[model samples]
Target: MKETGQFEVYVEVLRAVIIAVIFLFLLWSDRKNDLKSWDGWRYILNGFFFLTFATTIDITDNYPSLSKFYIIGPTVLEAILEKIVGYLLGSILLALGFFKFVPLIADYRREAEARRKAEEFSKNILSSVDEGFIIIDENYRILSANRAFLESAGVEFTEAVGKKCYAVSHHSEKPCYESGEECAVMHTFQTGKPHNVLHKHISSDGSPYYVEIKSYPFSRENGRVKSVIEVLNDVTEKRQLEEQLAHSQKLEAVGQLAGGIAHDFNNIVTAIMGYAKLIKKKNASIEEAKKYAEQILLVAEKANSLTKSLLIFSRKGTLEVMPISVNDIILGMSELFRVVVGRKIELETDLLDEDIMIMADKGQIEQILLNLISNAKDAMPKGGKIKIKTAFAKLGETFIKVHNLEPAERYALITVSDEGEGMDDETKARIFEPFFTTKPVGKGTGLGLSMVYGIVKQHKGYIKVESKKGIGSKFYIYFPETNEMPIGMDDSTDKFFSGNGEKILLAEDDNHIRRLMENCLTDYGYKVVVASNGNEAVKVFCENDDIELAVIDYIMPEKDGLEASKEIKKINPNVKILFLSGFSDNNIEREINDEIKNAELLTKPILPERLLNKVREILSKEKELTSLDSDKLH
Candidate 1:
């Protein structure tokens, strides 16, 4: 293959050129998708080395022939290969460096977007919260304040940013930490923990505010305290509500105690009054003795009134419901009211034109009026005018808003007004609470208005109070109105009639009660037979077949009043039955059927006069029954 040196050199040069071109093509042939980072760059570098090695071998094998032409011809192939190798190496190194570090650039972009979103969320939370917030640096300088905090402090947020906390708030000459009285922010920074404190702050209007502050330490990376974040809350209204709840609970407990004692005392007073009346009647000829008995009775009656007042305060008294004209009740109490109010305080009355009937217990209603009148008189101790007015009232929407009730159909409006020093809003709010009195101890029990409130509520009524500090007070009692008339004895006439010889059967559980009834009826000229139990009374009546009246204790043992009444009616349907018991009217009426309820009811500890009147009335009516019975017998 060796020929002339120059020819050989020329062949080598051509071969080197071919090798260099092939290597360049190989690098260009590696496409964008085929470029596998550093590994693909390494393959391109190895191809350049192989081309250089082939060019060196061609130049070495034809050295003498290439030197004959020129010194450059001999190494020309080597020099070209060397240049190609150097350029390929530099390109491979640049590609490998870019591929290795490009991932860090993508990560930096992702982190920048996340940080932007977090900052936006933080800004939204700070702007919208109702409560105030403040952040302070470790040196006790304000770092930031929210809109709420700035508004509450009466300053612009920008103006407060770099000011010391105490300078802007308390107007202190130095920082709160330097003054050293346990500032919440300073404490949080010092301990690197949270500090909670309740404090008073004066608002822009000079009104005091109760605020709760929670401060937590904001720490740096090296565990050093940097700042404090504080959250503020206004608790003024909440504190007032708690105080009101406590006052209400105190009144309730006192009412319960007072009511329990009153209930028990009522029974004792009833017994005392009954025995005293008996004494007075029996000792009529002994004038001094009779007078003493009557005096005792009077004292006991007064005590009964007091007990009734206590029961009303406790809301424990049972109401004896009856239908009565409001006009009549007012008329009945007017004279008594005038006497109590006396000459110093002027008394005024306004009665409705039309008769207004209401279903209520008469004694309770009377007591309610009397208490209000007494309170009015006391309010006007220096002798002012007192007015009592009654009318038909229908509640309106405006009334409902003030009184917290739905508008009602009709009401019996009773307004009691006095020209005396009135109450404030605070006093008015608590006036109806039991045992809450402005008067000194022993002067008032503070139960007057509370009792009024309880009774009115129990009757499905509402009351409103209006008063000013210097002007007088007016109390409006709105009692529900009814059209039904009251059915009961009229005690206006004191006349007692001797009975017309009608036979009667009296059934009583208590021996004393039985004796009292028998004596009262026997004195009135009626043939009276006494039975201890309902069973005995029923058996005796069935055996005799001549009983005209059957009076049975509704709650008695050994055949109750209702059962005995049914049996007696079976024997003689014409027999009149009267139920007597101390139990509640509801308990008796609830268990009894409608057919048996037609029997007249008499609650026990029966008044002697009431007993006599009922007996006389029954016998007078039985005269019509006797003829009917005679017809049936024939």
Candidate 2:
């Protein structure tokens, strides 16, 4: 019995010792660790101490004296006392500590999960964006950057953040603006508004490229900008494309001009060459020589006209402003256009009664008309009427707003209408685009309307087109009216001047110039008897006895004007004579002054109105003298 009791006490002491050692170790660890601030851990520490105390009491109870120390009359009260003071109390304290601690642990887990989700969302957004995005603080330090920004900067994210932007991107020691470079971030910070600009950047291959930067201010407080968000888009390819297109357009324009010149000059050269060969023939007679010479002169006139036309081919880059009447240009081209439209098409004009004038480049205006007319002709491969009209207009507020024009009140509107195969909506929309055309490939430059558009805009004007497929198209061009007039201009300058029905002999040595003169006179209602040279003038003069006047050129092939006029005078002393000279050749001017009695010499390059007015003045004076002599005889 005694040995069994001692063995039981030894087992109890061992168990108590193990429990107490665990409690002391736990307390020592908690005190040394960072977990000392944890109230839950502190609660557990108090519970452990109680457990250890209860275990000690159990160990002591193993002794017979301690076991019955609380017993009374063998009622077994010692067991109850043990339960109340040790095991029961210790179990309650442990339960209470666990109950207070579990919720704190759960809260810590939820917070960690939320932070992980937020970081993931931010990383996804940074990776998905295409443009380089960077957040910069006021100190020029890079706070954060997306994947694109890091790649464009040629730096890793780990190497980029917390570094100066200039140091990382530009490899400069100081800020970008300090080196006289434009900084979008600086602009955003200074203005507290969005900033956009084009910047030159270096690529990874060490080549230069362009980038467009759009930066916006963010985190603003108290009217102060705290940070900026920069967005960078590389525009190198787009810029190169634009430059190439402009170059191509220029080349196309030059090609078109060259083609036109080659066609016209070829005809002029052929005629001149052929006539010169004929004149060089060994068996050619004086008359044949004169005839061929006249033909050569005519070719020369055509060349001169072509040269004058070339003067109008100024580039849109410059302007030569002049006050010109559109009606006059229309009227002057009327005879030529009849042949130009190919006999099938009818040309009609409805000009404003006032002979409206507009401020414009004369050559560009001519080009506009020619292009419209040619397009009209092409539209009607079968047959159609092309009508041109000019009217004065007052652009209202609505029109000014729609066209985005300068605040101008009056404008001249020109409309070219064609009854031909019209264009659909898609065609109309793209007609003015450079290199856009409906013509067959290799047939046209397709730059006509596009150039026309550019010229109108260059002059601060506007153009509009209305069309329907299979119906027709009308191009409306508006030019702002200017009050300023060029010097030496008349309200009625007769670029299309005409004459009375007077019978006259027209003589010239230059065939083309003579032809030009004849065309003008015949169109003006004059009875023109044409002569190629001085001898021809004299012969034609005698053939028409009733020819009222003799118009002569001083320089000619066989017989000169001074000699011819002498012969004509012998035929009829009362005959009137007018001499047209390109210039006063000293010898001819001297001879003409000495020999001719009441003849008037007019200079070359004379305006049509000047020529007609001079001829009329001479003829009117002759009639006045005839009337006076007849009155005296009566």
Candidate 3:
């Protein structure tokens, strides 16, 4: 609205100032770009600068006092040149600059959009997962965390980001490695590969829980791990469930075994009762009574054998573990094997020439052969070849995993192959299950193979079977090999059973067995002193200075055989001990093998002659026991 000359001059000066500001801003924006890409920015900036200079010259033309320039010419002379060079040239440069910049702007917009969407997609996926996911840099700093991770950590995004990953997840001042916990993330960074491990982590609420932590590493151009992505899965419930299932299966198996044992005992009792009645009713002669008595003793021995079998199957009894040759057991059972298989079947043995010795129960090993051969004989009613082989095996990775055995180098492999009716995959899979058998209900107790399995497992051995429906079956048993020499099989001895008036202290809780043993020892020219319990036995041994031997039962009411033996040895380390046990505990067996150097273990229900022979053996081995004491002292 102002028509004054002064107002017009002020408006022109303001327009030139605005153009000059725009030119400076454009040059600042192009500073970050490459020199080659500066062509478009150069044009736009120069246009603004020219336009501003031309307007300035025009504004100066209003004031004729100060209208001069060095880069151009006098204000009056450049008035025409200002329109051509400043306005026209500036407009042309801006038009060309915008033309070149158009495609560049469009490309920037498209690339920016693609990156944003990719980030959004990744966020959605991580947030939706149930497992906690996080990306952490090599410095242990948390770069990014998903919604799942934030919630699990019981913290907000502000609380977690940029903080050390161990600080958030472990709630610790130091890394997991410092706390004796192997950090999967750190392991991956160092190894340059994925790592997984079981980790105990603290939740946001500070409760401890177990997680399976999986970590992956990302490398840079220099092949160094730059960052790690970790996924955490809680597995606390799965491990608990597995333990409960195993316990339940064990209880069920015990119940089934008890029932089977009860039924078998009832059959044995009936036989004994029938034989007793026959002997009582027989009035023919002393010879007839003697024959009936022998029959009764034979049936009673069967009951004792049954008791031993029960002990082995239940895995509660002790094993007289000794280094025994596998070839010897197989050969020893050959006669019994032939009788059981009959003339219709052919039995062959392929034993290794080199002795393969393992620490195991000799009787248990014999039982294994008997059970397997019996199983094979039953499978082939029409008679077939049964082959037993023994060898030294390496027990490599595959064998160890298949049998779930501890990693070891040497194993004694015993293979029993039968050319008989075999089992299918389904039947073979559960063959080791207790109370599982293909035989008819009344035909088999289903405990034979199970007993073998229990014995093998108790020995820290493994058994596996391969079978085909119409073909045949092969069973492989592996026992850890030992360097110890095989036990001597020689039964002949020159030592006499009768003692030379040597005093013996016999301790047994059983009235009948103890009295019989005392009389048996006394009759053999030995002075026998008896004690009812282990406490009394210890007292009597202390009273009698000339007691040559102390025989005590393994399991007693007040004090056990092991304890009494320890006390006796403390008094006289040179005295020999003979331990008799009806129900031998595994701990006692281990003590006899390891700590008790002056003692020998003898299983109970032993014949009177055998008991006398054992006492004589221990008494005669005084020099031997003294030698052991000297060796142990050294």
Candidate 4:
């Protein structure tokens, strides 16, 4: 019995040692993990307590005297009872630990996987964004940058990391705050609030671009600003498009203004030219009287030219491009410009001695001149000198680049300078913008420079302006030079073409213009029947069967020239019709029907001589046709 009890004690000792060893191994394995967790440590503690209890029962069973000294129960019963309690406690602890730790481990694994996916998603969002994005720490050091930011900075990710934000964007050694430039990121970091700013960034290629920067603050839980997230949007093209739209609107406004005044001005010019021509023709025998009449004719022609310039400036006239002498235009306008600038202002010219030819509309070129002179006159409110100069320029690559001109071209340069209050840089930049003016309301239309700019562009030319605030302003206009010969003036006007006693119908809207036309035509020996408008012209044509031809003004109250011509053609198919317009040929073509045959179109303020010659030519053609028809009848 003694031997058996000793063997049992040894077996219990071995069992206790095995349990202790297994529990210790579990603790060691979980040491690197969250062993502080009750689930991990409680199982080991329970197993240790159970091992202690079992070993105590085993030693007591072997020595009954020690058991009696420690407890009043029988050794065998105490040992069995202890074993059952300890085993139950150990099993419960092990089961509780397994249940708690299994779910906790699964949750931990799931959380780790989700965190990884979130990081990947954030990276994808940053990479796919179109605008440049960057993250910088409070110290302005770049912590992270997206692909767009990397490209905009002209650097790789490796190079951008750890660099200063200002160094990367502004190419500076210090922060933008130190340089006096408003830094959105720095502000965001300092105030822990969002900030926005517009910055002009110089690219690596030495070109400048505009960007709108919006920055958001990244803060800690305690509301301490940790970093800033910057969003950069390029806005250069958007700003340019806005400027272009504004310019177009201004041009349209000015064009409308020009169109409104065109008809009345053309009528006045027609009356003046007609009366002057009649005076010159009637006084040809008196040399002095003829000379005075010729001067009146010259002034009338200049007025007519001015009217044409207004039409061109309004973009309401067709371009009549031909080789023209620039000097003649400038010299002819010299007296008018002097008068316009007033006696306070002195007008001077430095024209090229030799003629400089250019392929351009004569009226459009004159418009350019008039606009520039008018602008100069306005600049000098008090009294100043206005200088008009002309020179031939050979433009090369360097010159073209500096002046923003076409490459490898020759230009006829006309410079108009003023000794007046000049403009600042900002004002000079927008001088050619339509409706942009420094002059007060009603004092200026702000369309002069804009019209000049449009006319120059239409003629395939360029304008450059130089101004100093207190000094003066200078405008340089460059027209592409031409080698083609200019058209010679017609001296046929020295002799008048007298009309035979042929019945003619005339239509005019203006009373003065109509009376002048009647006197001129009657003096030339044509029996003239006058009408006030297109409807009257049609009526006159139907009532007067012997009328050889009809002259109709394009724009009238009741019916336009085109409608009257159509009606007259129906009444007399063989009658000759001459259509006169104050507007451009393009506008007339668009208004007139294409079916009207044996019809002629002329632009007004027509010279009296040209009118008579056209009438005579058309009448002769009609007579020839009539004679052909007569011979056919015979």
Candidate 5:
């Protein structure tokens, strides 16, 4: 029994030692893992309880006195109590371990799910945005890109991943910063602040596009910049529209200037032309004097055409689309070109043997020649030669596409080439844009090329410019060739007629013009009734009941020509009236009443002969109508 008791004690000692060792190992392992958690402490507490129980059992069995201390209770009850205490302690320890570890596992699962949700939300937001979004790391490598970014860059996920941002965006081997371009991403990274810049990017198809880029610094938890988030917005069309609006405003400003000059200049031209005609008529018998007077009249008519061109440029004139000979126009302006370009510059023309006929406004066509020559002259300040040539061309599909013209059309090709300091690609690109000029401020209105472009388009034509820096420039204007006969080509007949003993009413604002018209009318043997303005003309017309015809200026101080004509028509429904204007027919139509009848339009500056002939024609028609009415009454 003693040996057995000693063996049992040894067994308990070994068990206690093993329990202690296991507890120590668990504690050391927990500490190694840096886990000072409540679960680890609970594990140590359970181990300690088991070790203490083992020690207590060994001590009680070894000492009979300690055993007898529990002898007060029944032996069976004592044994039961011992077992119950052991079981209850084990249960408590197990419950504590369960409580400690289970909640930790649940919390870990919840945190993992929440993190997943956050990542998904971030990806969804990035993908749904319209503007291109890209994330780049500090090494300038693409970390991630959204759908918009991928679509804009024209690359797929597999292709874009692991590529450098600069390589993907600009196809550059180095970063944009290294290439001397403004780099928003680099700026954001260096400053740890957002940056914005406008950059020109080339698309996948090698087309140049403009983009506004905004780069925001993406920071780590420790507040260090880790990456950059770039937002790219395509602004190419926006920039173009802004430029167009600015050009339109500039054209408006120039139109106002042209309109004011034209109004004042027309009166001067009318007086000059009238006096020249009067001089020719007075010196008709003397051949030498008559020749000089005829020369003066010709020059005055040319000046009148120039004033008409100013009105046309202002968009206040109508387009008179008649069949015109381009060669005749060029030849007619040769002397003027020489005078305008000076003696240092040489003017040359290569006309076709046959005239190239085109349906266009003669004055606007002249304006086009003037503008092109003027531009050429400015280019050759040090003196160079300009050559004007004409040819007939059958434009093919390729030419039509390049020139934005109708496919497979015939055009009268007018080429104006100059040997002068030419322009670069950038300048040539914007040459036809309004308010774009290389001339110094106040030297050029910048509307010359724009006007030429407008006129060409208005006449169903196209213009192309070819130029190289330090070389020369060539402008090719193409007008659709026509087969119709040219108007005003038959000028051999007499344009003058002596007016019968008939009364005429003339309304003019300028005193000199009014006097010239009065003298011209009286010299043509017509009874003249003069008025300074539209209101005065109406008064004079009502007083003279037998007035044969009324010629009225469209624009006047009080009550314009249309209003005066309306008042005159109320008095006599069959009254003959003619509307004269310094402005074009389109501009006159805007102010004139369409209801006015028995009215004809005549544009100024009208020659004295044409005016007399028109009056005679109208009177002759009125006389035939009166004779028919008298026959019907009899």
Candidate 6:
């Protein structure tokens, strides 16, 4: 009986020990799997209490009733303690669980708020953009579009939603497919890439529209494209501006090239023309020789006209500004305008006021009037009225603001209006470009308006035109007005002024020009000492005392005309000096003013007549001074 009881107790003890070891292993495994929270630990502690209760039952079972009482008493007390411990642990576990979940709830709330803010920001950005925007799906369906995009297509968003992109926006009969492959959205969908397309679209009002479509793909992680976002921009104005820029650049390049070459060529042409004129004058009886010389003169004149046009294009021509009445200029040009316009066209002049004046080069202003008149005549192939109107305009802030410039007090406004075939808007925009002519080939070089435009700009003036198809054209020329009297040339009081027996030292590089000049001066009863270069001119002028004037070429070997003039003036301060240069780059006028007090400046190719007149004028002035000195001495 004792062995039986002992064996039963040992079996129970071994079973309890095995159960406790299994529970401990389970708790360790839960902790390793990151379940070390209060719930996992509570479950583990409950299992330990259950194991202790089983061991106590097994230990007291094989003992006597009294031993059982001893086990029962502690066991009951242990059960009470275990229940209290379990209650307390259960409360702690609940608190830990609540604490661990709080941060996740706050994180979820923050994520939701951030998403709302991001959505609001996206809506604001898309709404405020000037360009149109459209979002399309991978199947070429319109998913979303902004207000601008809807307005651009002349359709509402509700009406355009879920519609095929090609049908709604492009107004295509068929769906966008791979064959044409021109649509940006379709291309992006087909190739899973971004694409651009520039095409003309028509609005609901049937008006043509220019749009640039850029489509980029929104792709999924699995290498599949989800949707295409099409960004549409209305580039009509931008394209027009770019074209204008290109045209302007082209004209500027050509004008600059022509201007650079004109200066040198004009000098060569002037020499040729001067010699031809001289030959024609000398050999008048020989009709054949005269005709040939006249032919040469004709060619030179043509060349001179070309150079003048180039000068106008480059805005390089010198301005001899003088205040002139606008009314007088219009009246003076009436007969010529009539002849040029012919009897077919009526020329009307509406001169505003006699007092309206502009400080401008008279000849250039005449040319401007001529070009405008000619253009008007050409426009009126079948007879029309051409009106020339002049008026005094106050250049207030209104006018200034239009051009982003300061206001002027007053301006002389000259308008040339013609009731003829006017230009279209496109033609009007490009009319001022050089060599851009509507006239047939060989009829015009297209430089007329360009020359006019350049001249007006160079004179600190402005010109604008208003025209319409088949109605009429009007050109407004605004020249700054000056409150001053007209400056006129002083008339000489000398009796048909001729060169006297005064000796002139003439220096010219060209032999033919030098001899002709010398002969012309000699024939006019004046002796001339000729030199091929400036050095020789200086040597001769230094050796002689009766040199009444020194006419020197500006550019020469060994010594320049300026140096020769300086040396001559050092010897005789009273000596009259004149310079002749081919181009304006030598600064002859400025140099003369700076170096010599009262030196006269001249440009070459010098005409015999002009040369003679200048020589006579200077000699007469010198003789007057000499006589005045003699009178003082007496």
Backbone clashes (count) for model 1: 1
lDDT of 2 at 597: 79
Give the per-residue lDDT of model 3 (tens digit) for 1-634.
3355456556657856866776575666557556545667877887777776666665345344334322466655556675677888688778968876887788789989999999899888998988888888989998888888898788998899899998998788999999899999999999889999998665657876789999998545489889999998888788678879988867765666666667867877888787778778847477877887788778777677677777877776667689888888888889989999999999999999988888988888888888899899998998899999998788678867877775667899999999889999898888877678788755666788888998898788999899888778999999998888865755644333787898988989899899889888888889988887878888988998888888888888788877887888888876788889876776767877686785788887766778888887777778576789999999
RMSD of 3: 10.5
- Clashing pairs in model 6? none
Evaluated at residue 412, the lDDT of candidate 4 is: 92
- Model 6 lDDT per residue over 465-560, tens place: 999899999999998887889866555422234676888899988888888888888888888888888789988988888998998888888888
Q: Which 10 successive residues of model 4 have the least lDDT summed?
A: 61-70
lDDT of 2 by residue, 1-634 (tens): 7787668667767856866775686568556755533656656666676666666554333456334333364323554464456666567667756865787768878989999999999789877887888889999888889999898788999899999988987899988789887889999999998988888887768998998988899688888999888888899999999999989978876686677567879999999899888888999999999999888878876675445434322331344468777788788877877777999999999999886667776767777788899999999999999999998888888888788764567788899999999999889999987668888755676767877887777667899999989999999998887667655755655455455788899998888778877877787878899999888898898899888888898777899888899999899888888888755455665777788778888766554576777777888898899999999999
At residue 481, candidate 3 shows an lDDT of 89
Alpha carbon lDDT at 508, candidate 3: 92
| Tens digits of lDDT, candidate 4, 1-634 | 6787667667657866877786686668556555545654567577657756655666344455335333556667766776787777676766766776787788889999999999999899888887999888878899989999998788999999899988888788988889988999878877888999998877767987889999998655578888889999998898789889989986876665566456547766676666566666754557665665666677676676666655665677556799999999998888878888999999999988989988888877877888788888888889889999999888776766775554435789999999889999999999887667787655565767877887787676778999998789999888888889987876876555778899999998899888887888899989999999888899888889998888888789899878888999889887888888877665467556475875787777777787888888898888888899999999
Provide the overall lDDT of each model, using Cα atoms, as 2-decimal numbers.
0.75, 0.78, 0.81, 0.80, 0.80, 0.76
Each candidate's root-mean-square deviation in Å?
Answer: 20.4, 19.4, 10.5, 18.4, 18.2, 20.0
Q: Look at candidate 4 and tell me the lDDT of residue 458.
A: 68
The TM-score measured for candidate 6 stands at: 0.51
Candidate 6: residue 149 Cα off by (Å) = 43
TM per candidate: 0.47, 0.51, 0.56, 0.52, 0.55, 0.51
Winner on TM-score (1 vs 6): 6
